[model samples]
Each structure stands twice: as C-alpha cells, then as structure tokens.
Target: MRFKNKVVVVTGASQNTGVAIAKRFLEEGSKVLINSNVKDDLQEVYKELSVHYKDSVMQYVADISDEAQVSAMFKALDEAYGRIDILVNNACHQGIGPTFEEIPTSFFWNVLQVNLQGTFMMSQQAVSRMLKQENKGVIVNMGSNVSKRAIHNRAAYVASKSGIDGLTKAMAIDLGPKGIRVNTVAPGYIFTNRWEVLDEAIKERRRTNIPLGVEAYGKDIADAVLFLASDEAKVINGSRLVVDGGCSAQHMPIDVDF
Candidate 1:
C-alpha cells in the first residue's frame, strides 16, 4: 500500500501496459482515474478492473490529444478527488514502421500530437494543479528504450520517444522548484498484444539480446512505475529508468562464437 490515499490519473488504461500499471496502483491502494478515447468498451475495462479494485477506479473517456478533453479530464479529477497526487502519462499511439517519406505528413503530426504533445499537456496541467496544493506529486512519463536505440521502420515512434527524454528532463527542471518530480520509465520490447504484430525474426533477435533469456512482461514495467510513484523514488527525478532486462546494455550484431 505504498500509494495509499494517493489520487492517480492514468491515461490509456483500456488495455495493454496502461491497464497493468493502473491495476498495480489500485492494488497498492491508490484511487485511480483511468481514461480511454474509445468510450464503448472503456467502461467494460473499468468494470473488469472493478472486480479486482472494487470502486477504487473511475473511467474517463477523453482523447488526450485534444486539449479541451484533456482539460476536462483533469478538471473532472479535481472535482472528484479535490487534489492530484500521481500522474502517469501512459496514453500513446504506437506509430510503428513507415518512414517519413512513406507515411503522410498528417501521420507524423498525429503521432507527435498524441505521444509528445499529449504528454506535455498532461504534465503541465497536472503540475499547475499540484502547485496549488501543499503536497508534492510525481509525474511518470511512459517512454521506450527505442528512444535510445532505434529499430527499423519506427521513425515516428523513435523520434517521439527520444523527444520524451528531453521533455522529461525539461519538465523535471521546470517543475522541480514546485516540488513536482517528473521522470520516465523506458520499457524495451515488452510482450504486449502489440508485440504479436511484430515480425517473428525480430522478436527472436530481441530475445537473443536480452540477458534475462526472456522478454520482459508488462507487470515488470508496472512494478517499475509503482516504484517511481512511491516514496522510494522521492529523489529520483529527470531520470529514465530502463526496465528492459538489460536489453539496452547489449550491442546488436555481436559475433556468436561457438
């Protein structure tokens, strides 16, 4: 119950990594507001989670890319909870593959709008609200190891994630004065539903690089997010915690000597 009494807002919690993180937080005793743009099934996901947390989670359907919706979501949070404690910017459109020239210019803009701009907007709003309160808060940006190591056919995602590193540092510096800690949790090739869409050969190659001999799970990333949100990481700001099973530490194309 490290996050007991904490009010948390987790974007993109309909499924995948975001859902895992929100569930973990709920297990740790935090009141969570989970959001997803798809309104139809969002409540279903919330209700499913309710079986585990039982009324500790609320569902908010808002497109994080839209400033109005974003504002309304946070405002809703304030109205319901009266204050903010921990914010996890986990909403993102995984714009995989497609080079700049191959995809439409709008595609690039849309990716930036969701991944980079949305993250910036959420952090700013959360910080503004947190500043009004006497207690400090934590903002954990969901980043990818691809920010440091780029893979083939993921130009937009790579660029957005790399930008997250800069955004994380800048936000940390600007908000540190207000006692708002900002950091990123960069996961490398976690086995999500999205992973199934990747090429088999690529997955095999990634597995070979992982020192742990297996792919990292979404729960692993969730645990890391929980730690960063906890008092244990009270001093960990502007840092990128890479939870990749040491994937980033290995050099690709190493000669396998028999």
Candidate 2:
C-alpha cells in the first residue's frame, strides 16, 4: 500500500480511465474523493466503490471548468480529507468529430473550457491546498499521445493536450521548490467502453497501427499514473510518460513499410 492513508482526489471518475485510477488508489489504501459533472454516473460509481471501500471513498459533482463549482468542490474536500496528497486531473472533453474548419467556434471553445481551463482551475486549487499542508503533493494530468502527433479530426483535443504538456512543465518549475511535483501521462489508444461500439474493421486497423498489436486497458494507464504519483517518482518532475504501446515512437504504422 504505497499510498496508504494518502488523500487522493480524482476528477472525471464516473467511468473508464477515471474510475480505474480511483479504484487503483483505493486499493492502495488511499482516502479518495471521486468527481464528475454527471450526478447519476458519479453516484453509480460511488455506490459500486463504496461497497468495497466503504468510508474510504467519497463522491463530488462539479464541472471543473466552472470556477465556483471547482472552488466549492475543493472546499468540500477540505471538510472531508483535511488535505490532499495526490490529484489526478482526468476529466476531459474529447473533441472527437468535425474537422478544424467544419467545427463550430462554440464547440471548439467548449472543448477548451473543459479540457484546458478546467485543468488549470483544478491544478490551481490543488496547489493552493498543497502549499498549506506539511507534506508534499503530486498532480497527474491525463494527457494523450495525440498531443505530440495530431490525429485526423480531433484538432481541439490535440491542441488542448499539447497545452497541458506545456502547463505541466510550467507548474513543475514553479512548484518544485514548494514540495509539489507535476507530470502528465499520455495514453495513445486505451480500450474503454466507447470502443465496444466501434466497427471491427476500425478496431483492427487501430490494432495494426500499434506496434504492440494491442490497445492498452484503463488499468495500464492507471498503473502509470500511480507510479508518477508515488514516492518512486520523487525525482521525476515536468515529464510526460507516454503509455501508448510505443505508438508515438513510430514514423508510421507497421503495415506502411516503404
């Protein structure tokens, strides 16, 4: 139990990667607070985890992009946990469809509001709380390999993730001396519930593109996040840990050999 008794807050914990991270932390003996904008989904996850973890797990509903909601959530966390030890900024607005030109300006800003500004607001609150505590803290931002390599239609997502990379580094430098570490975990293709409805051909094409011939599961990404948040990564800061099955390292897909 590396995180035994640690106080962890994981945003976007209603499903998929967020739930996985919260579960892993709970298993490691952390007092966890899970947050999601969706009340029903968040409650469902809370009910499931509360069965196993009981008093160790709690849930909060808030849109991280909204400053008032973010502030209120942290205030509630303060009442519950006293102080935070680790923060996982896993909430995101995945800008999946529409090309850059085809996408509406409102939609683009909406993506930025949630993905970029949300991260900033969350981190700002986390750092404020951490600075007042006696122990150092860790912040793990959920990034994407697409931050480094652009995909076909996710222009807003790519831009926001790329911004996160820069933000992580900036925060690390500013907070390192104050006993805080900032880092990002960028996953390429992780198998989630959304993938369940995808066409087999599309899935096969994605698998073929990855050199590992497989997509990572939510647990895989959770492990990486845990490592970065643990004491094992005490010296590690301002870094991006790509958990993409070597997808970002390649010049092209394996089938596209010249």
Candidate 3:
C-alpha cells in the first residue's frame, strides 16, 4: 500500500475513469474523499466503495464549477482527514456533439466553467491546504490527448484540456519550491460505459485507429494517476503522461493489411 495513511481527494469520482481512480487510491490504502455533482451517483458509488473500504472512503456532493461549493467540499475534507496528500482533478464537461458554428454560446461557456474554471478552483483550494501541511502534496489533472491533437466537434473540450496542460506546467514551476508537484494525465479513447452502447463494427473501426489494437480502460488511466502521485515519481513534475495506446504517436491509422 504505497498510499497508506495518505489522504486523497478525487473529483468526479462517481463514474467512469473518475470512479476507477478513486478505487485504485482506496486499494492502495488512502483515505479518499470522493466528489460528484449528482447526489444519487455519489451515494451509489459511496455505497459500493464503503462496502469494502468502510472508514477509508467518504463521499461529497458538489458542482466543482461553483466556488462556494468547492470551498465547502474542501472544508469538509479538512474536518474529516485534516490534510490532503493527493488531489485528482478528474471532473469535467465533455462538450460532445455540435460543430463550433452550430454550438450555443451558453453551452460553450458552461463547458469552460466546469472543465477549466472548476479545475482552477479545485487546485487553488487544494494548494492552500497543502501549504499548511508538512509533507506538501501532488495535484494530478485529468487531461486528454485531444488537447495536443484536436478532435472534431469537441472544440470546447479541446480548448479546456489544452488549457489544463498549460496550467499544469505553470503550477509545477510555481509550486516546486513549496514541495508540491503538478502533472497531467492525458488519456485517448478510454473505454467506458458509454462505449458499451456502440455497435461491434463501430468499436472495431475505432480500435483500428489505435496502434495497440485496443482502447484504454479506466484502470489504465488510473494506473498512470497513481504513478504520478506515488513516491516513485519524486522528480516528475509538469509532465503530460499520455495513456493512449500509442494513438497520438502515429501520423495516420495503421492499415491492417500493410
């Protein structure tokens, strides 16, 4: 248990990659506070995790975009765990569908509010708490490969994730002297419950684009996050760890026959 006795906070911990990150941390013996905007979703995940983790897992419901709510969540964490050793900023607004020209202005702003502003606020609170502790802390932002390579119909998401890359670098430099490390985990084409609905042909066609011949699972991304948060990555900071099954390395999709 690399994280034994460590206190962790994972935003967007109710589903998909977020849930996976929280579970991995808990398994490694961290006292984790799981946050989600949906009360029911948070409770459901809490119920499942609490069954095994019991005292080590706690759940908090809040919209990360709201500054007050974000502060309240941290306050609750302070009361529960007293200190935070790692924070995984995994909550995000995907901003899927609709071309840039066709997308509504309100929808675009909402995406930024949750994806960019929310991360900013969450990290700010985490840093404040970390500053008071003797051990310092680590902040792992959930980024995307699309941040480096744009994807169709996800303008807001791409923009927000790209901003996270820049933010991670800036935070690393600013916090390094204070003993805080910051990094980004950029995952490409992660397989989640959403992919379960896609037809077999559609899934196969998607996998063809990846050189590894398989999409990343939530566990895959979780492993990267855990590594960055561990002592093993002591000097690693401001780096973007792409967990994309080599998707970003190729110029074009591999021709199966070639």
lDDT of 2 at 202: 95
Instruction: Quote each prediction's TM-score.
Output: 0.94, 0.98, 0.98
Q: Write down the TM-score for model 1.
A: 0.94
| Model 1 stretches with alpha carbons more than 4 Å out | 196-202, 253-258
**Which runs of model 2 end up more than 4 angstroms from their true locations?**
none
Which candidate leads the pack in lDDT?
2
**Tens digits of lDDT, candidate 3, 1-258:** 899999999999999999999999999999999999999989999999999999999999999999999999999998998999999999989999899999898988889999889999999999998999999999999999999789999998899999999999999999999999999999999898889999999999989889888999999999999999999999999999999989889877776546
119-168: candidate 1 lDDT, tens digit per residue: 99988889888998889799999999999889877788888999999999
Model 2: lDDT of residue 115: 91
Provide the lDDT at 68 for model 1: 98
Residue-pair clashes per prediction, in order, are 1, 0, 0
Clashing pairs in 2: none
Greater-lDDT candidate between 2 and 3: 2
Scored by lDDT, model 2 comes in at: 0.95
